[model samples]
Target: MPLSEYEQRVLEQMERQLSSDDPKLVNTFQGRASSGLRRWVLVGLGAVVGLTVLVVGAATSNPIVGVLGFIVMFVSAVLAFSPPRRSGPTGVVGPDGTVRRPGTAPKPSRNQSFVQRMEARWERRRDERGR
Candidate 1:
């Protein structure tokens, strides 16, 4: 079902808040580089080549060639599973225990329960929308 206008506005507002709060998160998920697909394809090719090399080495009874093939396969598997490095100011936990992101003011520290924290966040959102 299509969202109503109010729901759309709220969704947009939340997105805006997220982007403003942590642009790195938005960038990481956006797939701007288009390298993820290419990386996976290359990894698959490398694995196939490595397997072929391994088979050839085993048939020829060459330990060195087999080792090289194993190394290649290992590296390819590592790269395929490794998480992409994010280059930006990482989040730091303040002395008061609130996470502070780059370029953002530290949130007021409240010794509140999880439910209270969520309620407070919801109240703040409501206040923001009221404006």
Candidate 2:
């Protein structure tokens, strides 16, 4: 269902407030960069493994193994060079804590229990003291 105009306005206001209140949180809504970097690193590792296998097969004079090694290395190199999928901007947390795109409503803060509220308040107090 589409949001009513009032609902959209309220949501926009909340988003503005949230963003202004916690600038660091905006990026977190999408996610950290480590996950993407890890994937590329894995591809590089596979290439290294394939290269090692090729070297070993050549040294052992195993024609079949050498051919397999060559194929693997070629595939690994291609994968390592492939461009990563472009992820959306970070800090757009979805209902499940995963980041969503900007302009999407975050899951309602209604899920915050008393303890969570208390912790938030306490953190705010601590921050005020630091300031």
Candidate 3:
């Protein structure tokens, strides 16, 4: 559905706030380069070829060709679903509670309950929505 002007303005304001608040997030999202129609067409063609090769190899009782066809299918599928590489600092939460993403303020390491964290996030979202 088309958003009304007020809704659009709110969304724009939110976007600006997000961009200013977390440049890493903005960079991650903006740096993504989606595969175009040509890429999809190529992936489709590859899948078709893979299927044909699989069928042919199976019919001819050739295991190598069948394996190759399976590999091709797997590769095409991976390519289709994989997002573009992120350009900003990526963080992984280690088992020892190590969070390391550069270019951002460090969050205090407090062992809050999952429900508490969820509620906090929910409240923040609700406040933003109300704005």
lDDT by residue (37-77, candidate 1, tens digit) is: 78899999999888888888999999889988888898899
Model 2, 55: alpha-carbon shift in Å?
A: 0.8
TM-score, candidate number 1: 0.49
Candidate 2: residue 118 Cα off by (Å):
54
Q: Which stretches of candidate 1 lie over 4 Å from their true place?
A: 1-29, 87-131
Cα deviation of 44 in candidate 1 (Å)?
0.5
Which candidate model has the greater TM-score, 1 or 2? 1
Could you tell me the lDDT of residue 55 within candidate 1? 83
Clash pairs, model 3 backbone: none
- TM-score of each predicted structure versus truth: 0.49, 0.43, 0.41
Candidate 2 global lDDT: 0.77
Q: How displaced is residue 19 in candidate 2, in Å?
A: 5.0
